[model samples]
Target: MGKRDVDDDDDDDGGKRRKASGGFSDHAPPDDGQSAEIQLDQMLAGGAGLAGLGMGMPGMGMPGMGMPGMGMPTPGLSVPGASAAPELDPLKPATTPMDFSKLGANMPSQEFPVPRDMVEYLMTPEHRQILLEETGCDVDWAPDESKVQLKGSAEQIRKAQRLLQRVLMHCNWGRSEAKVRRLLKPKIIESAVLRLSPMNTLPAGQKTLSQTQPVISIGKDKKANDIVIPAAIVSRQHCVLELDIDRGAIYVIDCSTNGTFLNGLRLPPKTTGKVLVSHGDELLLQDPANDQEFGYVVNIQELNVREQTKLQAPRRLLSTEESATMGRDFQ
Candidate 1:
């Protein structure tokens, strides 16, 4: 057959027909490769044939392309144009303020006055001497003046106070208000808690005082020979025993030993541990079979070399008395 005639016969058998100009054929096209290509092209041109290919309407611009909302759901993300979920406020309070006058009357006030005896005890003669030297005051100057003024200007006072504070810290009285004020004009809570615990020494053995390092024995019996190291210790241990001498709370560590024990309890030997070595607390050494009693006496006067230094330092104050004094002096 001729080319044109042969093409016409093929179209008739396949149920296909060419488009008239730019428009689609009115009759349904046969399900063939060429028909599919024509349908895709029509969809890309913003036609309505994409629904037959299981796709929604094609978006404009690129050919045969579909956007997010063009029928298929996104793999893991929420749909576009969706409302955002509300978040809960974590900082909102559960209850509102209410009258608690009856409850308030039952609760005691928390205010505590600084004890006069405690204050006096902290400010000793040695401490006064140290402050005088630091402030460049007369050797015989007394700390009991109504207002002890510095010789120089305000800057000088501040400098002197800072120096005095350093001296007080050296003496180990950084916590004392009088000492802190003499050193730094404004005292702080941190300074108040900076006082170091006094060092103490146990009585030396008969062998030789020089050979025996001063040891502080905790427990009731001062003469108890046996002592317990609560934490485990190894061959060479370098550990410290920090204790609040006033409150009798002790923290011990075993640098390296198989272990330390307290009252026959097997404590982890090489780790840091805290135990209340109060009056009558028993300390027993496990390996050596030595034992010692804790808390012989809470001697506040038995100041160690380090504690003595702290006590001899000037007290710190929260504010400078200079301004008040200046106002009074000029007025």
Candidate 2:
């Protein structure tokens, strides 16, 4: 997550490139397999240091990834490299297929189903009120978990999480003493606290969308077209925008009566669908129901800066500029 500060070395071909520093050159070419070992060591050292600082390793049940058992493994801890031994592939097909179903069949059944009641209790009005107070949500009652549904873009999900956290805090405070005490047991509280702690969400030195308005224009166009949307439609329906960090791609979702269009092509109208928008490209959203049109354009220079900064140094070191140029061109 930390960027290496290295000098950009000029190539014989008059191209500019950066070298990988911060003691990472040991993993340079001719050591493809060895690089993994070096990286593993680095990760272990980093993880241990972080642990000493009271910061869990990337995957070690840390927040900003996801809560444990919520699906994803802790960020950096569960990676394949963390294991002492590397996994090996079988040389030939197994002589007999393994049966996993029978292994679980004899497992003892629980007297009661996994604690659905406890989960419900955690989301009760009193608990939610406590969470809300902690998370800064102004609400009369905790959110209804049963009715809570995540929708729209990733940004929307984040907003929802903020709201939910507040509700959770509020609920926590107002719950019955027994229930509150049970949910806030030391281990549970610690786990929750660690999971909710703030982190550096964006890459260091990177500018956020709010910091600047990225001007987008079509190919070879100096003057970009204006992106417009009627206030009525924006207010009534969800508008989601997705930016693909790796591809430098942008997608706009039209969840309104008006359909989204790029150039002259009509984009699909759905709550969830993707439309590619490149730098300087014109985006138009038309709503037949309301007779409205919205237009938007991209900024190419900013996109180029982003693309340049995103280029992986390891890949650049291992290959020539021509090769890298070809890869990007094709992509």
Candidate 3:
């Protein structure tokens, strides 16, 4: 090649090499590299939010990795996939309760211990009506009130027994100390309700779990849930309510594709974890941004008159230090 052509070729190669290195230091010192990694490890130590990491870095804005509350999913939360719910199987039962029994089910007769102290409850018109009509049991309480003999089919007897047990449990018959038990009376029924407000096609009403009904499933599919809310946004098995009578509490679990909201908080869909619910907490069966969902207003009957009074009792404001400490504790 001519001298000029060779000179041009060498100049081009030099420029290419310089550009490949980006005109900066091509290698970091071993110590400097280690220090940079340590700093990065510290930043990711919590594995929650990438604190102190500027957004200028590529991919730093990823959900659950970048700064929290920036459209980021919470750490450890399973971001729901953009997929449709599974189709309902045509062979499944039409209603949740029907899955357990066929039409017109009746069990053999049975006996159970129904405390005499709560016998007055059985005689109450409302309870009596339920026992006779629902369970088909005429519960004959022992004269001493130690036990009961329910004259009905087995299913009927079980139903009656469960009803009475709930009452006993509510009254703290076995849950309380002997002295407290004797002092307690069946005066107040510690209860709560999910009052479904009328909207779209849903009717106005309330659902109270009693007479042995502890858990009820909600959804649009008739075969899988006891409480069927026919909303286009509702999933086949939307959510579940677990009522704990002894503790006077209710737990809610969301298992929907759209969402289930409790007190304006969207519960993690399909999560096994349940949120403790109290009175006045609102549960929405659809995305809060949507207006077609039903809102169930929780109405928890006060557990105790003394506790109620204490809740309503006034209190002086805390000092600044105490307030700060309380805030930190909640955080």
Candidate 4:
């Protein structure tokens, strides 16, 4: 037979078997080599179909195995673009600092000890207002009124403390209300001496007994006054130089016909009580008779020393036994 006639006869026989069976099946077993070749072809075709759909077997760079640009979801896994889950570490305890400031937590209060005399001054409305405006903090007084507690941030509390320190430093100088309010600088005086000088020429230092008062009077009378200016324009008690040993302050009381000019500012007679005389301050004796604008000028100098002497020596009352012994010794 011809090749075409033989192929037609095989096809007719396979079609008649398929009609009787009603489905595809092996009409008869092929040779071992042909069957093996057909199985190999089927596997290759299945693998190619899977690769085109962007899927593959395990460990073969599959799309679900995080291969480049394939973006397939894996089982039991969360997709991207979601909140990150927290990871807890089992080896170490958390040591993060808690922020209590935002929770309205109260911090430890800071207290500043103040002098008893200075408590009222520091608590004044003006000073308190200054503290609040500058430091953004307020203070509370202790029961004994000896110290103040400030509540705020660390920087604010520190600023408030410094303000108090400055107030103390200035207030320690002179406890006078006017002086403390002005916040004047303290004068570290060792030995303050007061004496009278002439209107024309200032006198040098004079020798005086220690028993006399630290004050030296100035006037027309040479015998009555500690030092005298013989000019007719001077008064009998023109002015008195007082040395305040306790306060470390010097003052001049004007009782003259014209007035006392301290630093060219007049302390008019019977009008102003007294004026402070600090180091480098000028004490001028105004002469009403003369039409001159200026007057007698005296320069004050605070003597420098290694140590300051006590303002007043200590004193004690004599006991009965000590008095009796002293009386017997005198007799």
Question: Which tens-of-lDDT digit does each residue in 279-310 have in candidate 3?
Answer: 55667777667663466765654333212110
lDDT string, candidate 4, 35-99, tens digits: 63365346446653334332334443433434433344344334446455677899989888887
lDDT of 1 at 209: 10
Cα lDDT over the full model 1: 0.33
lDDT of 1 by residue, 1-331 (tens): 4445222223646866454422233445656646645665665466444343333333322233323543443333243465656655789756668887754243222211222323443345564456454444322222354223344344434544455434333223114434333232211111111121212233221111111232232222324322222333322332223343422223333332444344344443332223322222223333325433211222222222221222222333324453222111000
Q: For all candidates, what are the clash counts?
A: 39, 39, 5, 0
The TM-score-based order of candidates, best leading, equals 4, 3, 2, 1
Candidate 4 worst ten-residue window by lDDT: 322-331
| Candidate 1, poorest ten consecutive residues by summed lDDT | 187-196
Which is better, 1 or 2, measured by lDDT?
2
lDDT of 3 at 2: 39
Q: What's the TM for model 1?
A: 0.20
* Residue-level lDDT for 179 in candidate 4: 44
Error of 1 at 4 (Å): 99
**lDDT (0-100) at residue 212 of candidate 3?**
70
Residue pairs of candidate 4 with colliding backbone atoms? none
> Candidate 2 — worst ten consecutive residues by lDDT sum?
189-198
Cα displacement (angstroms), candidate 3, residue 142, comes to 58
RMSD in order of candidates:
24.9, 38.2, 33.6, 18.3
